[model samples]
Target: MLATFNSSWFKLLGIFTLNQTEVKAFPMRWFGFGFNAFGQICVHEELIKGVWSDAVNEVKVSTPTELDNQVDTSDCCLTTGYQIRASWSRRASLHLDGFVSNESCGKPMKESRGCKDAIVSESYLTLAFSDRLESWDLQKKEQTPSWSMKLKPHSSGPPVNLPLVPGGYIAMKPPLYRLLSPHLRAKSLALSAEHAILLTASGAVYTWGLGSHGQLGHGGLTSEEEPRAVEALWGMPMSCIATGGWHTVCVSDGGDLYVWGWNNSGQLGLPSQGLRKTLLQQSSQLAGAPCQDASTTPTEEPEEEKHEEVFISIQAFPALLDVTPSCEIRTVSCGCRHTAAVTTTGDLYTWGWGDYGQLGHQTFISSDEPQRVEFFREQQMRVVDVVCGAWNTFAAGVKEEVA
Candidate 1:
């Protein structure tokens, strides 16, 4: 019986002309990266059609015009010469994945060598589409390498797994190599992540790859291949970083607030329906099923603002959070769908969709905005650390001692 099965399989394989012409696609190289025709940065590995397969790295198509191209006129870019400078000692294979914009549209023009001085920061996996990929010597002088290869004609590759130093080569997959080259588009760029922190030039935070729930700060959502920014609070530069399942939160310089992604049970300090139904299944599970239907309404006067059902999942755009703008947020932490934020006054607030008291709220409730959690109210805890989990929230702070 076993031999018959094997023989039958071999015969089927032979019908497709097992011995045909030699096929050579992307040779198994290490890695590659370059600008695409639309000016987005592209990356790839050592395989044929490797970047495109969802099973492999998440490589996708993005038009150059669909990105932000405005140069951040902030002191950071101006002071650094709009060029990324590299510390020779910090030469690591960096992969930066995100988005970039410029003032001009369509095609790129040559800028002065000094323009790249502003880019002299940390290591990254992939970068903005139009950013120039070059090397820096000990003296910080940019060294141009001579190599010829196709770029992403219209595609790019995974944004993580890059070494944090130099002397590494990036392998570019098809279509991507042909589309995105500094020779094609101007100041546009894109980014990706491999379970790491991705800091943008404009004080924004983007995270992707994996981490059950707390790792993405996207609530209790499963996972995402593309990148997303923490949108609750803007104009804050994050320093340290940490991640967990289904959620990811960061701390800012002066302490502000920002979050997005999942909100199953208000874990993100945002409201959401904890109910989950698979693509083929539908279930009506509710925490507080409001009992006000058409029958309950009195034959229609000016109807009150109808509350819409919230389905917490990965968000395409970052949602700005509602927090006391007057209170300076000192730190933030994310869990599966719950989040905690410490104010400068030593006060802590939490929200998002949580089923396991992850919000520290004592009970499950979908909080669409920031809410003060009683767990930290009694203690004048000075939060120093925060970590989020798939369905758990944890924080470490110094308890205020009675003087």
Candidate 2:
């Protein structure tokens, strides 16, 4: 008989050991909603025993208030526990009711560090987080399904047409944009979409927007009004790019990994959190101080006249991953506060935000540096692909059979 509790907020959540040897609690005040507006739970064995023995309170409620638009379940709703239900190759669509703890809760002996709840259906892109649920349609943008549910913002009457940011809309769809010339495609996308990134079939990189902590990789604190190519990686060529909140990481074609921007918790594989904190302190601390060095830069050129000002501040810079030359990583993924990677040798490594076993090390302690996932040591497995939820990790590939 498990005890259950309900509240508008969950700050009172806490856990205690069955032996009474330890007690810990997550700070409710600091428990801000994440990408998916849900919380994750990763606990030790003793603590789970207490929960199952009716010593704890569980939350029970339906989410999204209620399904606004009904769809044909005959075409969807297999409910396998993946965030989206359909395969990535299919055209089916479905809504998900994801709660990190919902799929993860089980007896202590079978603890899982991967996503506990996900509802993915066949859609090209299924992105879920503590803050938002996003899906992309690669088939036909305009002809595809559009949001139908009406949302009532705090003071609103009814949700109407979703408001677009200034200069946010494009007359053409994503496929058309991809088919257009690279320069034209780049110019059309919004500079402010958080997930925006430029990738070449051969792996070049560029970015803009929300560079406060230098997530843009442009070596500046200012968000660009337009797309800017990442010159530092001009010739290197990249295979993929992933963003984690304000931080970013890229993978190279030769199984090499490069990371930069917002390394607050060692997400960039850097030695300090100084760079991240500097960006938050003030806009002036960023590299693109529009007014600095004005006197020395010469005011003769009219185009350069904008440099007329004076101030000293911190600036953003691209920091390379400090890993040794031999690591040879192949795939990279980012969670809201952590990162995971799979190397060519079939080894998996993870770091940052282990509070809910997001690191999959079977521990709640966080690490500042990349740590090989030793949890699978006994299984002798090989992780080929990796995906990260807001606070959990998912990997697929081959693993040795158990005796």
Candidate 3:
């Protein structure tokens, strides 16, 4: 028998699909794009559609591809799976037949734990049961957890996994000690490689943790062990926030977007010399022209022009990012070196490391500014939310339900 990626047991809040393919109209709620070198996105050998040609050392997926899970229940001696989980490097689906398929390596193993939800983190599996969360070292023969945390009956959610990092996560509904805001209450939280950002119910934004890359949004790059309010956005009311490897992006209540931290590859949506130079080399190669090393050929900008340009390598504090005044941003998500945002009008915009087509633009060209993913618009699908993996993106769209 064959099984598909159904959003049943693993019901992440903002994932689903709506398909009108006139064939198997499964809701295309969950769509993936970008790097699939390890098959984390496709969970298979390779995708036939929307896949770009890869170099000798890479597999760049340039378009949004939906998740398809086909299981040979009888053939593999496996039972029907109930849920699936994904990390930066692997995909694991739990089966009711006492087995788990480690899709990352195309191997199925025997298991017999009825977990309600499972999250694939950088190194281990975060299993959520009805009353507790367990951290299991499935790589080891022992199924027992290195440690475990009992959940409160009223706990808000599972520990949110931080992208592109080791042993990094935010156990939300956290202890008062981690949250320095005594009078304010947190409504949202996001973690990066080495820092954390928080949004308060009163519209205040706070950050803490490692700030070597200025991801903390402070005027200087100083790590903060305690939460510090971002004075740069003192009065602005932010609605949402997200973090990448070493950058942060947030949306204001007014629909404006703000970014900070490392812009090494324009992950902050700011001009990046390195990214520009790389794009130029790619363009030159595509045009059959000899590519010049940036070291050998200095930038063509006149000295006077260079002097006048800000040439921001890093924006240490929160900086307003202008996508468009009319495009009111509702939410945003950051990957290892890219960013994606959903507009209020059901539009999606992406930028930064497009080397893997995380931008969903049908090309493997990276950008230093925002660009619309026209594929979804062309299909008349309305984007509601987006989630970014280390080098890929997952988005969910909504459509009028079929009767």
Candidate 4:
């Protein structure tokens, strides 16, 4: 299924992974963790029960917290996994599977013959059907659906007044902002707090916008007006790419993870000043500290004498990270100051700023290297996909039942 969207934050949420024998919906679950001062990642009860207080924003979810939102199933059926349409322009669409009916004619992904795509801006909502694209001016409509839910048998009349949620279908139109008009043949695009990264159909990646934090991956801290190829990543074909507040991470077709840009919060999965300080504190308390592993865990003897304080504040070029010795990466996502990835073996790994437990390691401690989340593993579940919010991480997976 060919997927396309206009927002820089758009990523296919796997809306069509159904069993061949059944065209109906399948059961899916969502697990979220990290900062929730705004209750954006809170479960239904957590959002409704907790009252705003000075210490509320200080609360952080340090582990995989099962997120539950009451989605109305009266008008539609949720056949499969949930979706979180993260978009920079605030425009997004949740993909689902319905059927051919009168209500689906104007649905964003309603039973189209060709590739389906959407463009949502402040003034208009344009949809690309099989043979043609249509636009509807929002200013002309009296009452517009809260982000139109896209899929076959589309349900389009839900009034959405809250923020993004999972477990149901929703089409989120951008509140308003400048639109991204990519001149390149880009297949996937991701937007950071400042920089922009785009992956072409050929698997080559290009970056532009703010580079002050090396988020541009241009080997220097210089901004760009037009898209420029990242020389360090040349010759390698990447399958996925993502951007964070000031960092970038992309997985090659071979499953190797490459990261660049800022490391202040260890977002690059490389040793950062903060992590080093934590390590030093641990070493002072313990006899020996292991720093040989790529995760920078306390496993091997420290090599600090052999090398100066080997902490990276900024990685000007792409750095290969061996997150797991034998496993390959299938997908990756970045938060404002954290990063998360799903391995080929169905394990989810996370690193970086964990002040609010976005790392999902059951702790608030931050790491300078990738650490596999044990929640899913302990539950005998295989994580298939992951997405990052500004301060939280969500992983979608299925239980791996013992035979």
Best candidate per TM-score, number? Answer: 3
Clash-forming residue pairs, model 3: 16-29, 17-27, 17-28, 17-29, 18-27, 18-28
Ranking by lDDT: 3, 4, 2, 1
lDDT by residue for model 2 (162-200), tens: 111111322113321122243422221211225345564
Instruction: Give the root-mean-square deviation of each candidate in angstroms.
Output: 21.3, 16.8, 7.3, 10.0
Q: Candidate 2: which stretches are off by over 4 Å?
A: 1-195, 273-315, 322-325, 401-403
For 1-403, candidate 4 gives per-residue lDDT tens digits of 1123222212211111223233233244668777665444544555534533446544577667665434344445533333543322221224344221111121233332232444343344444433333444444532333233333322442221111111221123343223344445566667665677878768999888889988888889999987799989899999999989899999999999999999998888887976777656666557665534334454355666444457899998899999988989999999888899999999999999887778999777788888889999898888877878777777777778679
The RMSD (Cα, Å) of candidate 2 is 16.8
Q: RMSD in angstroms, candidate 3?
A: 7.3
Instruction: Predict model 4's lDDT versus the native.
Output: 0.63
Overall lDDT per candidate, in order of appearance: 0.36, 0.43, 0.66, 0.63
Candidate 3 has an lDDT of 0.66
Residues 1-403 of candidate 1 have per-residue lDDT tens digits of 1121221111110000000121111111111111122212222233325334663222222111111223444322321111111111111111111212122221121222222111221221122222344322112222232222322322363321221112222322211221212222112121212243455435566555664544455544445565565454446666534333344445566554445444554545554444322211221124343333322333555558554455555543344455776787776654434566767776667666543344555453445567665544465545443433334343444455569
lDDT of 2: 0.43
Write candidate 3's Cα lDDT for 100-156 as tens digits. 555333334322243444445454555554555565443444546655666555455
Comparing 1 with 2 on lDDT, the higher-scoring candidate is: 2
Alpha-carbon error at 298 in model 1, in Å?
A: 8.2
